[model samples]
Target: MSPPAVPEPFRWTASPCGLVLECRPLEGIAPHLFTTRDAPLSAADLWRRVGRALDAERVATLDQVHGRDVVTIGPGAPPPAGRPKADALVSIDPSVAVAVLAADCVPLLLADRRSGAVAAVHAGWRGTAAGVAISAVEALERRLGVKPRDVTAAIGPSIGACCYEVGHDVRHAFEAARHAAHLLDRWFVSREPGTGIRESKRLHLDLVAANRDQLVFAGVPEAQIHACGLCTAMHLDVLTSYRAEREKAGRIAGAIRCRAYNPA
Candidate 1:
């Protein structure tokens, strides 16, 4: 079956930011999008969404290494480095559209209406364990002078707990992280039961839940966060999953740029 058409065509903006993009014409915040190696489509297919007149050279990508590092790109900001070991990108200039490519990792988008500052982040188990979302929130508050309460955060599709199975290392990482300590038992549950016979166990990591906690911990209000609980692994008809697609899978992109400045 063909993938469902995107809703909203490209308009998925709230007050202040003045802009949004969708995957398809009707898909909210769907354009300004690209396919991953896990999706049904590939980067070559993404070109169609970008338009025939656009140049592929304009698209930027990083070697994302699951770290809390963030880069600023605007005006004279240097071009993106080869898969920089980072998770977040921030900019106040509307010309630049901050993007994050992910198969199951949380596609986090942050925008401040007052300053027109926007951020795109890739937060996965490692990223969440490393506090990448918190880093993005901090960057917005410090660099953009945005009140944490006013920042609108959108936590896009990712691998939900039902599909994410983790190892001890994953659980340990969260335990080692500062604020993550509270969700220890809750984050990691034993798949096996019975006394003295612990055969197997798994970390049912709720990456989105963890990120939401991080946002709130950083002072973002609950109402400001918009989480689209669409699981990539569960929705093959709409999303792409690296775990399911492996190397041959196509990717899905989450992107945003300032639009109030657009005269068109």
Candidate 2:
């Protein structure tokens, strides 16, 4: 159950069960990790183990409808009967951890340094178009009294622009969603029809850039955001990719817990 070693900015931690990836900046903010494909367990088992390893009383996840909904978790709040249909989970309860599962989509983790609130976001292209990242940041500020400038984000592995070619329909969706024109231009890289032996015009969406920009737009400093920049499609040795493995793909999770559980 050992994961292959990853590169700088991301270190792999080994244990009896498997490996999890941690980044330095976010490591200083909270107890968090991005799980790998090397774990020899079902997704549920692995997530449970993640909660235990972080010493979290419980871990909260979502049904991930790929929308902008944000769910807030607290120790005193009653647990819901079913997983909430949302793309993001936020918590100020230090005993509770928040996590998001993904294969090709981005698993983004956010932590508030001043307030010790954390959020786990699942941002696919659809979620990105829907501004899910901005929603989470705003939720932290509105519900937990955390400022966007005080939040630090870790953008996990997912499909990268290098391999995420899209058709005009995808571009049209972003436009219809009302993302700023400049951002659309930057995120969607284009290749002319006759260039590079290709027969048609192509566009590639940079999911990382899109989400990072959205965070900055929400008032999180550009310097405070950290992107693993590892593409799930390219790093199949340790990561999972639905686009690469198709029906056989397993999911990876980004989980985070507040450093301590003080409710004062």
Candidate 3:
């Protein structure tokens, strides 16, 4: 069966810094948005602006090691000595916003409706193969008794299969990571040559598909997960693509803050 069509496209909204992309499902639950390339501010200033827009005291960021490490922040949680070396950050504190930065990689924002918990996840190829998204869902469950089914997720722009071509090394790495065979087939497809182009043998891996499937596997309802389906390489005017831009590429951020505490 073909993959589900992206339910909705992310829209550009005037934000505190400049224009940013907001996901409707996540926006209804809490303060959240995905940064775009329209803004000319430095990376540090952009992050600060995002935090201010969300009404958060400060934004908690991760070191993003491209692995499955997940860190949780909440009451009594000690301050991180420096940036924590994790790919995902889960927050149950309403005053703190968690953010993840990406260029061609996927930046995912998740929110738990019933508990007001939130998470920001960064999943590059290695991180997706390692199941960082799933780790974040589990972190929410383990830390605040939030169920994955109650979580709503928004997958931000990234390198789509249309522009992302990889060699056998990436395929072999996923297999080595022990992903199921069927999923490997669905996420990785052989590229077809186009008009005036030679038949390229490289495989195209769908990072969004891989991460979305992992979220479902972790128990998030399929309908609650929204993907913008924008290809960073295809829309450089509004997005950033590390693969397409190389050393000059700027980062895109997905930021979300936890909901205010209300004693049950």
Candidate 4:
């Protein structure tokens, strides 16, 4: 299949059976993509599609419990018995692709420019509050010896602040996460009065901003972090969004792979 024509920051690239979005900054360093709603419907089919697109021999994903746990995969590591209960996957093996699925949550991909190590993070509000992005960076540093300064991240299409309204409970969640409390004011926007009823006077949570800030706090340079800026809630035609589609919403995935090892 030929690469489809896509807009700025995201380019269409032929997968085995369909086209996926490739972040320009991550090109060459890692074979990664942010899949759209046009991709396959089933999890197995989606994995196969991603494998074909990147020519990866194997792919790894998670059960994605909105937490900070990071699962590591490599050459000698045993195959995952089941979807591990984690929100992030990291690997230095070129043949293995790590992916994360999300509907409204941020699907974040990170790559180490020097080591070629990569990670896929599923950062929903809960995971964001738990510092999932920072956890991924720390995992890379601890497991692969990749420093945060050398890492580049791409925050994929998700529910942007414009449409992600939340209640005080959401604010309380972040506030309770003392490590993230200082950043809450910047990530949450309180809706003005008359916008709706009392309960609807919600705060809009910026998942992307929260994740980006966490990455920066983890030491990734602000300029190296790229956000797709495509709001899933706003771009229903090309993306799936839980906020806009409710239970009927399908998921989009963000995947990344290391460069093939060359011993020569």
Candidate 5:
């Protein structure tokens, strides 16, 4: 599907998608700030929107599969079908706008200001269980020699706990992966607030919390992790959701790009 066209002199919206304002906290970063919604945008509108703000011709995006794959952006890229399979992409190059598309999955943006490196990740329950956030951070450190402390992150909107109902299979997967059988208890919900919720508890999985915990575990500063706490299922009018609307709904893309240093 083609992207929405964004006119020149763009306006940033908190949107139901829950974007962030980090580079210039008071005014926001780059050319635009957003997470995707079911909102229809033409190709010209979309590219024109991102390019004018980023001074580039297009936004780079990935085909997400809810895994821990990390792809570093370099020269000589292929089209969407031919690009390497990965849930995340990082780059020091400004020309590549790290982007990911999702519906009810978490979209994450990270930046190491000191190194001028940026990344965008697609995290779902499967990816979270697979430790994709840590994978992305580790990739940054291993591939580019960046410190977690220097990395600031924005956890964009997704299916929140209030609406992210999950099954025992999902919980068990994460618990088994982390080897912290206790973490399952910390993240689940039940009929009664204090009751043991192992088998009987119907849980609302907090995707943001899961990713935030990973960032913390990876040594990202507590102050630097910003979470947009909106639930895609709850706000169907603005954002898209596979859980709420199923295949009837379309997908929204999350994007971030490197911009030239401005002396403002």
Candidate 6:
């Protein structure tokens, strides 16, 4: 079957810093965004921008080790003394926003519609192979008592398969991780001619597809998942792309905060 139609739940809006992609499905339910290259110069600056856009006071982020580990921020959870080394963050506090920074890797934002919990994940090729997306979903279920079916996810722009050619080691890594063979076949595509070394024939891995499938496998309804379908490499004017810009690329951020609950 064809993949779900391109998600229409996101809207790009101009901000003081630049443009930010907001997930419409989570509007009013949460404050979230997929930041663009024009975000800010530093993390502090970015948080300030996010605060202005979302009216949030405090934001939490990770060191992003490109692993499957997920950290949870409960209500009133204290800020970490330093950034934690993890790839994903989830929170139940409306006062605290969770964010993940990325250039080429997928930046995924999720919200629990029922409990008002939220998550931000950075899923690169390695993290995707390690099931980072599924880990975040399970973290919400186990830590926040969120039901996967009630969660909505927004996949931000990343290095699309059109430009993300990888070596065979990437495919081997997924295979060694014991991911379903058939699904692996679908996620990794053979590189186009003249793309990579002619003799070796590199592969292009779909980080978005892998993470989306993982969310589905973790119980999120496919229809509820929205993908921006914008490739950072192809749209560098609007997004950052590590692969295209190499070390010069600035990182984009994806952030989400739980909706404040006013007890009647």
Q: Best lDDT goes to which candidate? A: 3
What TM-score does model 3 achieve against the real structure? Answer: 0.92
- Steric clash pairs (candidate 4): 15-53, 16-53
Tens-digit lDDT string for candidate 4 (1-264): 233344476676666646567889888689888888778456567788787677788788899899999998864775486799999998877878899999999999999988888899999999998999999999988877887898889988899999999888887888788855557878987677665322556788889889889999999999889887888988777788998998889899898888863211
Off by over 4 Å in 1: 1-41, 45-59, 75-83, 189-200, 260-264
Flag clash pairs in model 5.
Answer: 4-41, 4-42, 4-46, 5-42, 5-45, 5-46, 6-45, 6-46
Model 1: per-residue Cα lDDT over 1-264, one tens digit each: 433333332223321111222323212222243333232334354433433212223434456788899887654675565656678887654444556778888888776655666677888888888889889888877755667776677777788888888887777677678654556655555545552212455546788888888898889888767676667788766567888777755566666654332111
Residue 185 CA error for candidate 4 (Å)?
A: 0.8
Root-mean-square deviation of every model: 6.2, 2.9, 4.7, 3.4, 6.1, 4.6
Off by over 4 Å in 5: 1-32, 38-48, 75-81, 191-194, 260-264
Query: Which 10 residues in a row give candidate 5 its minimum summed lDDT?
Result: 18-27
Colliding pairs, model 2:
none
The C-alpha TM-scores of every prediction are: 0.76, 0.91, 0.92, 0.90, 0.81, 0.91
Residue 231, model 1: lDDT of 75
State the C-alpha lDDT per candidate.
0.63, 0.83, 0.85, 0.84, 0.68, 0.84
Residue pairs that clash (backbone atoms under 3 angstroms), model 3:
none
Could you tell me which residue pairs clash in candidate 6? Answer: none
Cα shift from native, residue 198, model 5 (Å): 1.6
lDDT of 3 by residue, 1-264 (tens): 222233464566788867778888788788898887865436557767888888888888888899999988865784365799999998878878888889999999998888788899999999999999999999888878888988999999899999999987898899999999899988888767562112446889999999999999999999998899989998887788999999889888889998774422
* Model 2 CA RMSD to the hidden true structure, in angstroms: 2.9
Higher-TM-score candidate of 1 and 4? 4
Model 5, span 16-128: residue lDDT tens:
23432222331244333554553333333654554444555566666677789898864343334355678998766666566776778888888776766678889989998
By the TM-score metric, which is better: model 5 or model 6?
A: 6
Which stretches of candidate 3 lie above 4 Å from their native place? 1-9, 40-43, 78-81, 193-200, 262-264
**What C-alpha lDDT, on a 0 to 100 scale, does residue 248 get in candidate 3?**
84
CA lDDT of 116 in candidate 6?
Answer: 83
